[model samples]
Target chain A: MKHQRKPCSLEHARFLRARKKNLAIVWALRIGLLVLLLGIWELVTAVGWSDPFLTSSPSRIAKTIAGLYSDGSLFYHIGVTLAETLIGFAIAVAAGCLIALALWWSETLRKVLEPYIVVLNALPKIALGPLIIIWFGTGSKAIVFMTVLVGIIVAILHMLNAFIATDKNKILLLRSMGASKLQILLKLVIPSSLASFISMLKIAVGMAWIGSIMGEYIVSRAGLGYLIVYGGQVFKLDLVMSATCILCVLAAGMYFLVVLLEKVLVKNPDS
Target chain B: MKKEMLRFSSVTYIYHTVRGETEATRGLSFTVEEGEFVAVIGPSGCGKSTLLSLAAGLLKPSEGEVTRSGSCGYMLQRDELFPWRTIEKNLYLPLEVSKQNSPELRRRAKDLAVKYGLGEFLQSYPPQLSGGMRQRAALIRTLATDPDLLLLDEPFSALDYQTRLNVTADVAEIIRSEGKTALLITHDISEAISLADRVLVLSGRPARVSYTHELDFGDLKNPLKRRESAGFSGWFEILWKELNQ
Candidate 1:
């Protein structure tokens, strides 16, 4: 049996090896491109080809980040922004799902509010910054509210479409068994939308960051967004670059965490 | 005489949409007795699905009554298994929904799966199973509650010809052995003739029973045998003409 398997098994092994090699090559190229872009920026700045004052070399950004680290204020700003963003994301997701469920529960309510929802979604959120400041004041409360405001609409729209798009046959099957509307929602609707839910989370993560930073841009005292604003006002280009870099890393980290959640929560990710 | 399991008395259903109200079924009357397998055949879009929905009580009749003796288990065209759930969990869904979930019922459900050759696949997700296997799991899930009536909505229509025949045989044997009353809606004349004890042909849209035939394949209770019997094609020809006319 072992001898008979040798020929085809070797071919299978070769195919697997080629797949692994292709994946490695793809990842290597991704990293290599990032490193190459940074190297060129640094080389051009160091050689006086571009004004380092305006562009801010990678080395200068690194130095500014180290300074923030030594001063022990690095984590504080990160914590403030991260906490606000996470809290806003959670509230928006929860409240949005509830609102979507209510809308799905009543055709009358959905029809009545459909135009208003579309209008709210279309309106530029930043235009309401002054009103938000007036309502919540210039505190973390305002920033968190802004984050929720940005994320919740997206969550509601995404989840509502998913809820409405649930398989009609599955709903019929459940209904035939005497399952209540609530039961259908719990057993079929919610469970079937895990993929959409994860995708919504991915979008909400971006919206949460946008809302927080946008709020900070309006009236923030301390955050990466605050640092970016203050650094710009003071003409400290290195600080601005460092804060932007930190925001990128934090956003990527949060996105990866959502992806990780998709892996754990959705048993059949492909489906 | 077997007790009456389901009765549809002058049932009429109209679907209201933004465009207009369309009458789907009109003055449709039928009765399904306990322990009998009844099949409904009609042209496409002839309100066959509307009839099942009415029977399942998912929709109320527009102008008449749909009365059933007990609860129903519904199987659809596609398997409609929740891909996120294991076969075992999917089978238990009806029990959970009906508030009849218990250790004994779950065990019984599991035993049914094992009996029907899904023992090894119980831990597997629906996506992991073959199409035929998924449909079988769906039938088992329907039977989990031991419903008084089983409403099958073109349950074999999704499978390819080969798998459809095998699964049809399996489903017929299972239903017969369980002695469950079944109402199957299909457009396939051969399928209607092979499986049902009594076959009801429906008119085109605004459907009502146009003709009803009692199959006579004496002692050929198995679907595959019923198909091989001499009377199978004769009944099929009759249903075909009735359906076309």
Candidate 2:
């Protein structure tokens, strides 16, 4: 009788066990780096190596967060800032998609508007903050307008390139199948540009936050940006640091939301 | 005996560039019979794609008439399935474009997907599919509109050698089973011999038909099986010599 070979289940199990160990090691290394940085910052402040008042340690920022939470000011300011960022982002997306569609539809209009778009995109959006406040009177309207101004141009540029770069052969294929021009745009062009559009939306999320913050910095009654400016005026470094941290968390949350939407819509996790 | 589905009479195409006009196809005349599979083979840059383009009404002939009886579905070399759309949505693209998006048609498209092996992957995006599956999905998308004539422009040239053979067999069976007329433009001699009922070989640029051969491989249906037939090598050798000449 000839000897038979087995399936080598032990080797397979060993590979799996090693993979788990490697993943755990990577996670531990990441957590260790974060802890070490926090520990060093705390140690430096406690030992009088750096002034906690000026550079506000992580513990001071954490205490400030708790204090603000107890007083309910943190939630209120966060709500206001979030509203501004979201409204601005929504307007930018709508306007940007529309402008991109218009440019994709007509070469003549694209040619006519190309120079103006380039010039406006090159201009510093921050410089327009004062003019926007003057025009919209330092209210939520000014913040929203500034956000749209900052985010829409970049979104339009990205989406337009996506739309224009759509597969020409595919377009011709659709056209030969008796598809109308509007149908091509809705079916082929829109579907093809969706991934790029999602990426642009994620980018616009950050720009929207930045725009909203700049607006709040110039003129706002209540917001995280206003809190930062107010804290700086009163020489409260902890408050300023806490407000910055909150902004970071909020922006990250929004960005992750867009990424999740992309995952659901595009259905390709790798992309 | 079949009725003529497409007639290309003295069709001439010229590539008008900044340099000047260079003829791509000169006075090419051919007629595709109804329910026939005709493969156009030629050397590289010999206007095979131009022929399909003219047939599909994508490119207007500079001289003479290129007329077809009914609607045309053109498939490119690469499977251009939209990465964002599900396989099911991609299949419904033609119907959606034609404003034929009835619930019944949508269900039929789904049924077709299921009838094909893609039922399990209907909700999957293009990137999730293997190259062969994507091509099948693309073929389904092309066939969704129920076009009278299908123009395949080197639709399998992108696949690897092994995958190409399997895909060619699958596609040939699918097209034959659907009872649709097809015009395949390819440079692969074996591919042309295996899938087509008739093959027309073209010469270099300003392309014209050099020879037309009627392929008969007895009862061999699958392309790979057909390749093992006695007549397969003979046809391939003839085509290879003609292509080189």
How accurate locally, in lDDT, is each candidate? 0.92, 0.89
- A1-271 per-residue lDDT for model 2 (tens digits): 2233655588877886798899999999999999999899999999999999998999999999999999998899999999999999999999999999999999999999999999999999888776887799978889988889999999999999999998998888788677888888987889878889888988999899989999899889899999999999999999999999998889899999998898678655234
Among all windows of ten consecutive residues in candidate 2 chain B, which has the lowest summed lDDT? Answer: B217-226
Give the CAPRI rating of model 2: medium
TM-score of each: 0.95, 0.86
- Cα shift from native, residue B20, model 2 (Å): 4.1
Candidate that would win on lDDT = 1
Query: In model 2, how large is the Cα lDDT of residue B154?
Result: 97
Cα shift from native, residue B147, model 2 (Å): 3.1
CA displacement after TM-score superposition, residue A76 of candidate 1 (Å): 2.7
DockQ score of candidate 1?
A: 0.68
Where's the lowest-lDDT run of ten residues in candidate 1 chain A?
Answer: A1-10
